[model samples]
Structure formats: structure tokens, C-alpha cells
Target: MSSLRAFVFRMRGGLWTLLFCIILALARVTRLSFLLGLPFVILGQIWRFWAAGSIGRYRGERVGAEHLVTWGPYALMRNPLYFGNGLIGLGWALMSGPWAICIFVAAFALLYLFVIIPHEESFLHETFGTEYQDYRSRTGSFFPKTLPERGRLTGPFSFSVLRKSERHTLWTTLGGTFLIGLKGFFL
Candidate 1:
């Protein structure tokens, strides 16, 4: 289980994207599927951007943070970035236009919840100690438990952070969508 978790933690992002892209490339995607799924992809990107922008200096390593960030999306959900990734993958699955793809998306989410988050949370707990515990006690892991705690917003939204955190995601999403759209167009 630990090895499985480690594998997921290391490879979930790239592997899942590749899986979705490969499936979409081979599957028959209709215009309706592309249309239906686009909103989810957009929303997911927005969520990721928001989370990345808000993290400011804390966007260090994935398994660790320089400081505990409980602002912006962090105030709402413990793992907003991962949640956003789920949305993006689900969007692509929907665009792929097969019920089986949806199952894959659900399975991916389950893996995230069970394998990835536990490992990440363990690292975070070790790193941030009581601060993370306090944040965890109050915040939902994947859902908003309360309104964002009133506080000054973290530093001005940083494009550098967004680019640093999401460049690959942004490009992969666009490229995959383009491929899927092209497939829909030609077939």
C-alpha cells in the first residue's frame, strides 16, 4: 500500500493526463461531449490558478511547504490543487464521451483521496506540526466547511507562481483539448 501510495504521489498527474489523452485520441468524441466537458476544465483551471496564486511563497515542494497557508482556497479546502486536478481530469473524461472514462475519473479521485492525500497529509503534519493540525481540524479536505476566514489576502496574485506551478498543466490541458477537438472535427 505504501509503495502504491508512493507511486501515485509521484506519477498521478502525468500518468493520468497521459491516460486521458491516449483514451481521447483513440475514442470517438462528439461535439456535445467536448462542449459539456469544457466548463469543468475551465473551472478546474480557475481553481488551480486561484490556489497557486494564493500560495505565494509556500508553493515549494509538493510534499512540504515553507509555511502553513490557510488563506484563499486553503481556507476552503485542504487540497484545492488536487481537487482542481480532479475536475480537469473529469472534464477530459467527459469530453472523451464514454461512461468508462467517467469510471476512470472516479477511480483517479479515489486514488487521490486514499493514496495521495494520506501521504501528503502525513508529510504536512510532520512539517507543519500543530499548525497543520489546527487547519485540518477546521477545514474540509475536499469541500469548503466554512466561508474563507476573514483576513488580508495573501500577496498580490503572482503570475510567476501560476506559471511555475501550472505551466505543464496548462499546456497539457490545451494540447489534449486540441487533440480531442481535432479528433472530433475529422472523425
Candidate 2:
């Protein structure tokens, strides 16, 4: 189970990207579906940018932050980045239309629930100790239940952090949306 969790956690992003590309290639998108999915994709990007910018100060040359992040979108959700990823994926699935959206979302949810969240929680607990535990006690993993009750607000939003954390995400989202739009246009 641990091995599976590790594998899924490590590969989740790449695997999802590949899946989205394959789905896009196979899908017969319509103008209506593309338009409908556009809003989700946009919202996902906004969420990612907000989370990234909020955590920029703690992101100095490390994957694990020196302190817990609980501001901006983090104030809303424990896993805003994962939530953003879900929205991006759901947007792509919606663009695919029909049963594909259901399958993608189901797979995504299972992956997050069974694999990603557990692995991340273990790491956070180890790194941040009581701070993470208290935060976890108050915060829902994927959904925003309430504003964070603890943790110091980080410094102001940082474009550098946004650029570093989200450059690939932003580019791929735009590219995928463009391809879907092109497919719809041509069809």
C-alpha cells in the first residue's frame, strides 16, 4: 500500500497530463462542451496562481516548506493545489463530454483520496509536527470548510513564486484548452 501510494504520489501529475492529452486526442469536442469547460479551466488556473503566490516566501530552494502555509487559498483548503489540479482535470473531462467526464473525475478522486492525500499528510505531519496536526484538525483535505484558525500569514503575494510553481501548469492548461478549442473549431 505504501509503495503504491509513493508511486501514485510521484507520478500523479505526469500521469494525469498524459491521460488528458490522450483524452483530448480521442475526444470529439463540440463548441458547447469547450465553452462549458472553459470556465472550470480558468478557475483552476486562478486557484493555482493564488496558492502558489501565497506560498512563495516559504518555497525557497526546497520542496518542503520551513513553515506551514495557511493564507490566501490555503486559508480555504488544506490541499488547494490538488483541488486546483482536480478542477483543471474536470475541465478537460467536461470538454471531452459524455461518459469521459465521469471516468476522469472518478479516477482523479480515487487517486487523490487513496494515494496523494495520505502520502502528503504523512510528510506534512513529519515536517511540521504539531503545527500541521492542528491545521489538519481544523481543515478539510480537499474542501474548504472554514478559514484557517492558525498559522502566520506569509509575506505578500510573490510573482516569482507563482512563476516557479505554476509555469508548467499554466502553459499546459493553456495549450490543452487551445487544442480542445481547435478541435471544436474544426469539427
Candidate 3:
């Protein structure tokens, strides 16, 4: 059997699990709330774009930050992108109003807490060492500990980052919601 880390990584760092569950649960059941969740799908895409822009040009797959992003939404929460993704899942559950979807969201959150976050932290610690430790000490993992302050270092903000990140996430976010709507409309 594959090891736990292997399995989690295969889940694309737990994103696959949440996306699958969101699609499965919402598509399986039809409801008005699912329609309500449509907006959050768009918001999720926006969050993904902004977070990627903040991080740099590459996707979130790189854990070892060549540089720390202490600006943008990152200034508010260390993991705003992940938190926003969770909100997307939460909105999906709200849209579907399905008990099963709710369970899936809870499961996703737990898996992230237990499986994904720790692995990512270990990687970050190894990568950034003391800098990462200090960031973690001050930053909240999933919530904002304090108000955001403007960044000291300014780099050229790249829309390409948005395009790049959104390219991967948009399909899952919008397409998954579309699939749910399709099921709701057709079946």
C-alpha cells in the first residue's frame, strides 16, 4: 500500500479530495442552495488567482518559498488561499444543502488539518528554516490574527500569475459547479 503521505500527495495535496466531494455531493443532489453557491465558485477562482499572484509566478506546488509573501491577503492570513478554497467547498455544501456534502466539507477540513497542513509545514520549515518558523509564529494558519498592513517590498504584480493559477483551478471550481448544476437541472 502507498504510505499516507503518498496517498495525500496523490490527492493533489488534498485539493482533489475536496473538489471530488464537492462535485459528487452537489451533483448527486439538487437544491436551490447549490445555485446559491455558484457565486462562491467565482469568488474561489478570484482568491486562487490573487494568492498565486502574491506567491510568485509558479503554482502553489512549490512549498519552499524562494521568498516569503507577507503582502496582499497573505498579510492577513498565512494560508488565505487554502482558507478561501475551504470557503468554496463550504459554499458548495451550502448550495447543495445536502447532508452528504456537509460531511464531505468537514472531512476535507479534517484531512487538511491532519494530513496536508503538517506536510506543507514540514516542507516549509525545511525550505525556509527560521524565516518560516517566525512567519508561522505570527500568522494564523486558517484565520486572520490581525489586520493586514501594506507590504514593504513591492515586486511587479503579474497578471500572468492569475492566468497561470486560474488556468488550473478555474476548471475545477467552475466546471465542478457546472457539473453540479447540470445534475440538478437534468436529473
Candidate 4:
């Protein structure tokens, strides 16, 4: 693994924070934009919460897959977490300004496509061997795949897992939403 890739992977949180701050700073937020964006935010968070439930505790810098989770959202997409993040980013972009979506999309592609996903995929492929490759072929990376034969892994989706894994995401998203609200309503 490239050291640069590891650094970016580790710095994902900071990068996302920077993106949010950029959106807020360059905002032309309005009531209509906020309203339009709310559904996306809600849906994104829900998707993420569900995905997190299956994945157990959130590991920020650590990149290791202990179990091959092949059920629920994992069964749907190889990168449900990233997909949910995409939705959330789009929502924030919409709320921020007309041009913010372009910026967010560009940033997302650069980060996830160029650095993050490849690194993670390489690790997963090495860690899980044939299982991960099989999953990769059958499942879509960012969307629910229409596999001719979808694989399933048996496991319980725990609320505890969701709570543990999603608190940071929940708070961060709420904070962004609140700031956007302030910008839209007061500023």
C-alpha cells in the first residue's frame, strides 16, 4: 500500500470536515434549498445507520475486515457506507449553493475513487481472498446490484452496533445541518 494512500485513508475524517466547512463558507443557502436537501440528508443518514449496524464499531484509521459481512446493506452494495456518504454530501451541497454539488462531486471522486476505495478494496481482497472477490464481482460498489444470484451471510443487525458506529456521523451531520439552517434562516 502506498504511504500516501494510507495517509489519505487515515485523513478521511479531516478531509470530510474540510469539505463541510468549504460548503458552509461558500454557501448561498436558502429556505428552498434547505427544504429540498432535507430528504436526501434523512435518507442518507438512514442508509448509513443501517450499514453501520452490520459493520460493528466504527474504526477511523484502522483498515481491517474481521468478518466478511454479506448480508443486509452489504448484500446490496459493496460500499453502502460510501454511497450513504455520497447522498449526505449531495444533500449538503444542495443546501450550500447551486455550484456546491459540482465541488462535492469532484472532491468525492478524487478522494473515494482515486485513493480511498482502491486502498480498501486491495486490503479486502487480500484479507478475505476469494470471498471478497466473489462479492466484488456480484455486488455493485455504490448501489444495490442486480445480481443473477446474490450471496447472503447470516448475522443479526444490532442496534448497539449502529449506536457505536454512527454517533460520530450523526453528530457531525447534525452539526452541519444546524449550521446550514442558521445560514439559511438568519444569515
**Candidate that scores best on TM-score:** 4
Per-residue alpha-carbon lDDT of model 4 for 1-187, expressed as tens digits?
5788899999999999999888888888888999889888989999998888888655569688788888878887888898989999899999988778888999999999889999998899899999999988888888756743444543568888788779989999899989988988898
lDDT-better candidate, 1 vs 4: 4
Worst 10 residues of 1 by lDDT: 57-66
Superposition error at 46 for model 2 (Å): 0.7
How well does each candidate superpose onto the true structure, as a TM-score?
Answer: 0.86, 0.87, 0.81, 0.93
lDDT assessment of candidate 4: 0.86
Kindly state the number of residue pairs that clash in model 2: 0
lDDT scores in order: 0.78, 0.78, 0.68, 0.86
Ranking by lDDT: 4, 2, 1, 3
Q: Which is superior by TM-score, 1 or 2? A: 2
| Global Cα lDDT for candidate 2 | 0.78
lDDT of 2 by residue, 16-100 (tens): 8777877786677887888788899999999888888887663322236667877777777788887888888888888887676
Clashing pairs in 4: none
Using lDDT as the yardstick, the better of models 2 and 4 is: 4
Q: Give the best candidate by lDDT.
A: 4
Count of residue pairs whose backbone atoms collide, per candidate: 0, 0, 2, 0
- The candidate with the higher TM-score, 1 or 4, is 4
Report clash pairs, candidate 3.
Answer: 33-95, 34-95
Summarize candidate 3's per-residue lDDT along 1-187 as a digit string, tens digits: 2257445745664566555665565455456667677677667667767777777766554345677777776766777777767767766666666674667567777677777777777777887889888877777988776655555234446787777776767777777677667766776
Candidate 2 regions exceeding 4 Å error are 57-63, 148-155
Sort the candidates on TM-score, descending order.
4, 2, 1, 3
